[model samples]
Target: MNLLNQTNEKIIPSLFLLLLITGLFSCTSESELTQVDVVVYGGTSSAVIAAVELAQSGKSVVIVSPDIHIGGLSSNGLGFSDTGNKEAIGGLAREFYHRVWQHYNDSLAWNWEQHSDFGNRGQGTVAMDGESRTMWIFEPHVAEQVFEDLIAENKIPVFRDEWLDRETGVEKENGRIVAIETLSGKRYRAKVFIDATYEGDLMAAAGVSYHVGREACDEYGEKWNGVQAGVFHHTHHFQVPIDPYVIPGDPSSGLLPKIADEKPGANCSGDDKIQAYCFRLCMSNHPENRVPFTKPDNYDPNDFELLGRLFDSGWNEWFNKFDLIPNRKTDTNNHGPFSSDNIGMNYDYPEASYERRQEIIQEHANYQKGLLYYVANDERVPEKIREEMKNWGLAKDEFTDNGNWPHQLYIREARRMIGEYVTTEKDILGERLVPEPIGMGSYTMDSHNVQRFVTEEGYVQNEGDLGVHPHAPYQIAYGSIIPKKEECKNLLVPVCVSSSHIAYGSIRMEPVFMILGQSAAVAATIAIDDKSAVQDISYLEMREHLMQKKQVLSLND
Candidate 1:
């Protein structure tokens, strides 16, 4: 209930003053205030658009978020978009793209590069005019600007830095969410609630069902499900077998730090683990905004000796991966053996508390930063590779607040809600038909490496990387977003919707989230009218609304 500063100093004065100002300036209409049609609990792209849609439809709404920076990953450092099918996007989701286009209307937005070089429209992501326009991909600041414009246009009340109370704060009465309380003890009452968090923390706190890691192939009848020990791509696990034991070929050095200590669970069993996480770094070649990588206080180059071993083992194909973002910035994700992805290091993060989560985040930062610093400085590194790595530096304009680290990490999959309709691998493979259709997802079933361990031949191997294609964009089920009808009837979740780990790989794209967010709002409006649970809302009505909004629901595309 108390707001503590980073130094643990009680910020009672400013907290009280801000509260007083909000109270005095707050809308006083008992009719104009109190209840809203919906209360979305994240400032993510989906949440923002949901609020915008409902408000645009003349419904009242509010967004409560723990992050002061809105737009979640979209507005954060992930400007290099993971848009599977640009044609699948529509409605407010596509409008977000248009807004980005509007930003480029001014020549100044292209400060880092020539507008011509920026290209014409995003690759294949068509504009509403049915014209090819370069709008889907954008820079960090550009994305934030678009989201801010939507918020201002809608006038939706956004309470920043409001951490939800996971226990009793989600007061459900008569199978409906009445109000939600944050960590600061402020209660926000509403007719319906939507959980848009990536972790689905609020959804779970509301007594909704959810799942956390990969389901064995048998559990979900999925080909790409479970431990993918035999699969290796983009990077070499070992043309030669790596020893899973301790001493390299000796079996006595004690398993190197990164390898698992136990027999990795049977290939097809459910486990509480997820793919490795790493910062979706936005590095700028621009001298003005770039910051050189720094040495950490706990600068232990030995922690990354595993990578050094990989380099020595003849794996120097660097540019084959590390996706490019824009304006001299790179999304620079995890690639190569022991690169940026902090594999096997962040399993407990999905459910950890703020302090604990911060610890994990900081540890990851140090680990990743140390990796860069080591590659750029360590004499152990191949001289040629070190010179190539040195050319890359942190983008200056990105992550200005933190020392050039991304505000968000590529949390590939986490806390998936067990909703009314669970989207399994069958949905992606077209083996099982989903009855309720809200939006569509058509990317391949993709889960990154969950754990990295030394093989029997003393080489490091990455496990749980599933790349089995679903052929084309598949239909994401409405059931995936709604919890079991019996529990919390009115709540809808999109980002953390129900899906097996392998199945979620396809649904977990930024464009899909935005499309789902728009669909979630349409459902919200319907739920308000019917005075029923989100699950009870008529799919026929919902489908019509979505078509009106231009959200691609069918796989016909």
Candidate 2:
């Protein structure tokens, strides 16, 4: 190794430096660093799919995930499907559902719910198929099994529970990511990198710009932008006014603990507050294998007064949405004012640290579990409602290892990267054109409440609820996944792609992410072949590959 001498001059003690020393040195040094054709960050459903596709395409690929599990929400408890237009799905995403059908092919898979009773209908779309093409709904283990099968068949490399160096890990030269260093001091080099995390952590760390919250309607020409007051969906609003002060009726007591001290944003503008998050719990009626709801150690009965008020006002019909998956488990979600979704309490979660995020996740779990415990045991919850709550318990066959609690918490919206191409509501609503289409997304632009605060008028109110339909399937641009060529050329982002809060609401689903992941792999392969930037990858070539791979691009006018 040569060192710079005094005065910082290139004191080349050139003793016959004619043997191509630097070239050989680079070859020897870089060889030790692990290299792959593709490196996918975030072990989400999409990241796994991307790795499998690239490996199947005869290219070496590796997936590095922060979480221990493989699948994102799909392998988590989100077994209940969220498909708006089922026909719009194709490619690997369709294959995922098809694999679920194969799992249920064995008669033993029906041990939980009745063959006829196990309904696959979600909203207007049917998640199951008698034709055996796809059975979209499944248990957590079933989903995990399918992902494992894909990994095994493709022989893809996967490193679970590997966190990326959130700062200063991305090594970029000539506008291309040459390699990335994880927190474990291991370096991974790849021709192309795909950010497949919901939080957009890797993308953000690589200097890929990303948006955090919703944009105003005027900013993007969107109809359903900004704070929507008086628009209550699924019974999470405050019909009565409750003061934000410490006391029940006093105004001079100042803001309470849960309510933030900052002023709420203008009604027409956007804010950083994201919608609520929850766990897609799996519960069963089988008492033998059931885990009864236990009071959380940090449970506070006062945290449930708002729910008690909602229950008192004749909203006791709790079983309105106990969507049952296979293996005697139900993918139960929030229903009433105080349920699984800790609305308005998870605003700062998307951008928080892992440890901080865990705190938030546990906070939600405690709140949700407390809600169940309260409804089942508390005297104020009404006898009829209490009885119904008591009968429900965690499914034993599902998440059997850890007190029957869900391993994954539904992080609905986290850190969304402000990428090269922002996918605004205008694109999904068909009001504006999105260039360089990669895949399609067809789901409702749905956002849960972000804040559940008592209004100044002494009534309770939940804010940050917006629901709009993406009337038809719309194309997602390839540019949305990558940074500008000047910023980083070799990175592709699927989960945290550029989208307004409204548009992300529709595109954030796992199936869409999987489809985009396959498309990103195709683009990466093409980029590697041509030695081109991610932005410079020819759409003609990418589009051809996508069409050949059966990944949907556009819908007919």
- Taking every candidate in turn, the Cα RMSD to the unseen true structure, in Å, is 4.2, 8.1
Candidate 2 matches the true fold with a TM-score of 0.90
What lDDT, from 0 to 1, does candidate 2 have? Answer: 0.76
Off by over 4 Å in 1: 1-34, 118-130, 233-236, 242-247, 555-557
| lDDT score at residue 434, model 2, on the 0-100 scale | 82
Please provide, for model 2 over 7-103, each residue's C-alpha lDDT reduced to its tens digit, 9 standing for 90 to 100: 2111133511321243211213532355677889987899988988797777777787776667988887888888778777778888998988887
Candidate 1 lDDT by residue in tens digits, 332-366: 76666567778788898888876777777888888
Q: Largest lDDT belongs to which candidate?
A: 2
Q: How many backbone clashes does every candidate have?
A: 23, 13
Residue 232, candidate 2: Cα error in Å is 3.3
Q: Cα deviation in Å at residue 478, candidate 2?
A: 1.4
